[model samples]
Target: MSLLINIQYMPYVLAAIVVILITFRLWKWKRSLNYWRDRNVSGPTPVLYFGNTLTALFKPFVYTEMEWYKKYGRIYGVYGLVRPALTVAEPALVKQILVKEFHKFRNRMPETD
Candidate 1:
């Protein structure tokens, strides 16, 4: 026995794969929504796979953070897809660093290893 394959059906296979991918993405979105709801931290409703903003159509930093500070009142929370993010309004901490001649400064993460 021999089997024959038709290239015409390839489009259907591709479409099915696309549909599956979209469905899985939606599932992850819904899961994130529920997680936020449980936390009770208020935020804007997400736009399907856009995650609360039109990041795809418009770049994330299209408008400077200063503009956001004006609208969101200097401080508001924003999420990147499924990740949680915080926008700070004021920098309450002020530390002065003085370097004389050959002083080197090292940058480190707040989470300290």
Candidate 2:
């Protein structure tokens, strides 16, 4: 019967689905790792998947930035989880980016109550 045939192939179908999901996850991880590279920016080396999670969990962002500032200088990029963030320590450049060009860079997060 058709039902018996499907039952026999069910395990193979499930395995194929699992393989596709794993491939998608690896693709996303690779894309995230390449974000700063595409922008020609560099920061501290990231741990696979976590991406600066150790310092983010232990130290305040400002403290972490301070340490990275000393190491990588004023302009560098960091990964907060899988997302890339640029940290600009220079006051003038920060003002220009955040204030002067505020309209150009819109918020990505949805507004919440």
Instruction: Tell me each candidate's TM-score.
Output: 0.42, 0.82
Per-residue lDDT tens digits for candidate 2, residues 19-103, read: 9999999889878877887888878877668888778788787788888999988899887677777778899997887789988
Model 2 scores a C-alpha lDDT of 0.82
lDDT for 18 (candidate 2) = 100
Show how many residue pairs clash in every candidate, following the order shown: 0, 0
RMSD of each: 9.1, 3.3
Instruction: Pick the lDDT winner.
Output: 2
lDDT of 1 by residue, 38-103 (tens): 666445555555565564356556464555667666446566666555555564411222234213
* Model 1: lowest-lDDT 10 consecutive positions: 93-102
- Please give the CA lDDT of all the candidate structures: 0.57, 0.82
Backbone clashes in model 1, listed as residue pairs? none
Angstrom error at residue 35, model 1 = 5.5
